[model samples]
Target: MANNPCIIIADDHPLFRSALCGTLQRELNEPQLIEAADFNSLQTAVEAHKTANLILLDLHMPGAEGFSALVFLTAHYAHIPVMVVSAMEEPDIIRRAMDHGACGFLPKSASIEDMTAALTAALAGNLWLPAGIDDTPAANEAELNIAESLARLTPQQFRVAAMVNQGLLNKQIAYELNVTEATIKAHMTEIFRKLGVHSRTQAVLAMAQLAINPNSTLEAFRSQALPLQ
Candidate 1:
């Protein structure tokens, strides 16, 4: 096979964007790649090249409008495939993107093997999913609690939580969410308080529990809590 495939990666964090590029460099042979740091940059990059084989999209870029960007891509470039790459392993977001024409989803915690598999599958016209999902819908009560919990958050806090769930560092989340790192720090404090948890891992776990079961309650989470670190 020729190195004819091209990829575009849209993310606000320069370091992560660069890291993704490196991943591609390691995994792909002579792959053509483009980088964008924001929504406008992504839009510009896409307009500049309509023939890209894949778009490695990050939904929570600063001012990127998340799913709205996915909609735009489907409307304008219906033929192109989009692989949502983010720390957001939230099943709802994953399912919703698939409903809207995304070709695949890659969680940030995805292993290198996972990335390679997803990319290869997407390139071969297959819709890819993480291991263990296995034909079952990712939903549940805990996911519902997360939804309710998020619904109760201020827009700023919600954005922060979303980024955190996506596995971004506070500084990176700050950049993508368009606030200072200090602001993100403050928001984390508030988010922990609101979610009744003290850490990002706990919040993500809570969301995962909720996603698998919408009826998930905080009490249920308490029973299964990891010992305090």
Candidate 2:
């Protein structure tokens, strides 16, 4: 069908990807599925097919690390909705995915029926979470403020910031992005201003604060939420 929707399935596991593709073929009406085994390929596919309807992203794919791909995509491609399809079923991980702007979280262990339902919900412009899981906002005010600051970064600034977080020098990032070191420096200046961080160390720490410690933060907040009359 020429009018069919386009979807990207980005997971490193071959069998898992095949299974997801098969499930989508059965559920969706002649969908155009693009498969990616790593974050680099995922980026290429998204760039090539700008009209993609949904992205099924695995959290641990090569080049993605943890939530780096999610953060980058959500920051850059806010128009395309993302649904995290990861084996990481930890509540904190799911919560963090949603907080980072995923429209849905589907565990790899989910049945075909459940997968179909979640995909449908996401395509219908609704948020989906595992059954019985609360969709409460996961991050506290301080953490959300950091996320908002990160979201404020332009696409190029976000890429440069991610490379910086990976300990890449300006020259290295410049070479990777095919731009001059001077351009990278200019982007860094804007990045620091948007993030309110004076130096690279502070900016990396700010991103880390948002990406790390969800479980501990949730536990602490839950403890505090307990009532004592």
Candidate 3:
């Protein structure tokens, strides 16, 4: 109910974003809205609008690998609250989003009333969960600990680690980030140190711990670990 609260809608879907914008404008008092279609752009928007009141992030965006973007934002932009807005509303994913630092989880299918309530709670600095979901943030677990470590990474280092988790080589990461390979190597060293893992494979495993589908990351890592025939 804060007057003219600035909100960033960080989802890739244009129609849905527009509709959500309309809903907020109608329900709230002159809410200022910003749109970001991808994770990278969300970061840019956050940087440009550091005073933003809230960010409605998509579960999957171009530069977001699982809940990594959530972790990065909560870590780097600790002041602004992030309420994840996504179509994937599985209970576990919603809980994990909160555990990883999301203020709320608003399913894309949420009714206008539900969206308004969730936004109100989040803006008031409270946690919000969808109907039938437990309001509590997830309990302490191995992934939470790993999230703590990943939270320590600088923005650039987080990007490097995310790229590494996707199996990108140092040179490839450097090219994508428009930096030199040696600079990337230095980043890798820091990322490993921060994550408490020395090798890229170990870093990958560490990062995988934060994936939305817990089983899939472990399974994929296991398949990679199997001996070649």
Candidate 4:
């Protein structure tokens, strides 16, 4: 890590973030810390600090879906490492997070020692997972394909697709992203092409394949839009 390595703590809960921040400060000797209370801020932080050394993410941020943000971060910022520090510490969620691309998973309840160790390991280009979690039943071929397809999207396209997955219309997406509807429409077209989907609904369905819902391979299946074949 650099002498003043930058780390982004991307979690929404204020108290938990504070506690984690304190632990990192104590353990890391106050490395440059950036706090983001939501996913949009996370994006802004990453964009502003492209040379960041590590990102500690929470899966349930305001604008993020479980595992989806991890996928986006890992995809868009392949040079920087991401470690999940989430309250959803079940083995299944942890395993899914790893499958989607996070280099480490530290449950919120983990000891400060373990948390600091996780952050350090990820910065060192290593994988650090929770102890005693069985690593089995890895992500399936379809899920892998879905993740790869999503990795094809640019950072801006990923943001547009995330909003579309939330069921937002183009104009509303434009308003939120503060771009013209025509600009958003052009982005949607590229998103659809890269995702191999034909329409907004299909684009959402394609990105939803990377979400936390294990059951809604149904939507992807029905839409037949993923082009993972």
Q: How far is candidate 4 from the true structure (C-alpha RMSD, Å)?
A: 3.9
Candidate ranking (TM-score, best to worst): 3, 4, 2, 1
Write the residue-wise lDDT of candidate 2 on 139-203 in tens digits.
66766777788778776676788788676899999999999999999999999999898887667
| Per-model lDDT | 0.72, 0.81, 0.84, 0.80
Model with the higher TM-score, candidate 1 or 4: 4
**Model 4 lowest lDDT segment of ten:** 220-229
TM values, all candidates: 0.58, 0.82, 0.90, 0.87
Instruction: Kindly provide the TM-score of model 2 when superposed on the true structure, using C-alpha atoms.
Output: 0.82
Between 1 and 4, whose lDDT is larger?
Answer: 4
Q: Number of the top candidate by lDDT?
A: 3
Window of ten residues with lowest summed lDDT in model 2 = 220-229
By TM-score, who's the top model here? 3
Q: For model 3, how does the per-residue alpha-carbon lDDT over 72-173 read when each residue is reduced to its tens digit?
A: 999999999999888898887888888888898999888888988999999999988888998566534778888899899988898888777777888999
Q: Pairs clashing in candidate 2?
A: none
